[model samples]
Target: MSLEKLPPLLALVCLAVPGTALAVKPGGTLYIKAKNTHLKASSSPTADTLVVLQPGKEVTYDSREGKTPWYKVTVPVDKKGPVQGFVYQANLSVSPPSLEVTSKSPDKPLSPEAFASSGAAVKALGPGAIAYGKTLSRPDSVQQLIALESLAASIDTAQVAEYARAGGLPEVVGRPQVARRSPAKKKGGK
Candidate 1:
């Protein structure tokens, strides 16, 4: 192309550059804090998952921007080199998580069953909650709340995901963005 055309082409390229989606520079390293958190394609929780990251896995990340609760990260996958994606900020930590140990053995990590059975994992309703429940008209409400709490505590993440899938919920069971609804108009009113 002629020099005159080249200048305009370069100007157009520069103008389009900032608007295009591009990966950010590595800001720091972070470790996965959860057992099976996903590296998603976008910042949204329901976005496509690039990979499932395990607890304590190290990943390179870009600094968080604005009020967003997602971090852009590059995770090293087996045989696939490094893959860039967004992970929930809550799932990442600046330092690796120390494995929870059983009371009997300080060196060994606590098994899932052991943790579930431990006193630390099971918490009864506090006196305040019980008192509040007493104020409610339904005398059996407290017992129902206790039952519901027990049921929720017993269900694991895997079980919840499976239940969602079986019930025809969204394929990606990760936290979904809250949709905003427009205000309803009154009859004959614009």
Candidate 2:
């Protein structure tokens, strides 16, 4: 290839190479999506927590590319200057999160402890999500969802490990497996 052609070819090759370039430029801003999340020293979840990032806080994007689950970022701490750390990508968003607090019935506000005790946060589906499910033309979608959730709940850690092994899932082979508590058995059903 000629010298002039090599330059264009190299550029194409670089672009074609996956995970080589940063998704966002270094120093570009990214907002924290979660209410609170830890900025870790490394990409892993078990890494040391460098700082706690709050919702809507802006952090400078450090070098990271492609489908990596973690984003390397520089967060500004009050006592400590700009601290470089890694945050899980799921905890971040490109746009700032809305800080507005909304309630269906403000006149009768629910207590935080009561809400926690209700277990609604984890189990209940929002009306909006249910409506979206309805729109997909499955009238019994809610029932199906509940059934699926029940099925998932019944699966123990051993079952999951066995399934992963039987399916030849290499990714889960060495990863720490979290054991789940067995669901409450029905009375006289054993």
Candidate 3:
């Protein structure tokens, strides 16, 4: 078609801007449901820890770009810039976590342990909690505790291997490196 016959929008679209444009926008919100989740530098668990996210933190999800079960999340450390990192999708929930703290009514008089908050649960089942757990004779509670422990251990091992493979971190951190001996020093620092 002749230039004059072209629609105004079409004419503008024909301009040779000589550049490419890409759009990036947050897709959805994901909540961290498990304690001690790491926001890794990449899509693997072994990636450097960009941030250690506590349970109940909300993050913006952009994409599920990798083969591994990881999500791209944006977290802000400061006003300077947002940190883009990957987190295992297993511990993530599509809905924001609703952690019940306690009864809103003071007159209700809740028990000391009535309302088990997420933070409390995290601390309660922490590494040191095993001793306390062993002392309990409650069958149901014991089973649940065992389940949680197994889940946590499996997740930890899988993440570590993923991070080691993708993040370029050594499987074992802080290993000693043998010093490389320099060939016989030529007379006085040749």
Compared with the true structure, all predictions reach lDDT values of 0.68, 0.64, 0.58
Candidate 3 lDDT, 68-161, residue by residue in tens = 6887888764676776777787667765455354436445543223334323344335545666666778636756877877777565544654
RMSD of each: 19.9, 14.5, 17.1
**Position 88, candidate 2: lDDT:** 79
Task: Tell me how far the alpha carbon of residue 138 in candidate 3 is from the true structure, in angstroms, after superposition.
Answer: 12
List where candidate 3 sits over 4 angstroms from the true fold.
Answer: 1-26, 103-190
Q: For candidate 1, list the clashing residue pairs, or say none.
A: none
The true-structure Cα RMSD of candidate 2 reads 14.5
Q: lDDT for model 1, please.
A: 0.68
Candidate maximizing TM-score: 1
* Candidate ordering by TM-score (highest first): 1, 3, 2
Query: Top model by lDDT, which number?
Result: 1
lDDT of 1 by residue, 20-92 (tens): 4343346667888765677777787566666776667889987564679888888887784787878887787
lDDT of 1 at 158: 71
TM-score of model 3 vs. true structure = 0.43
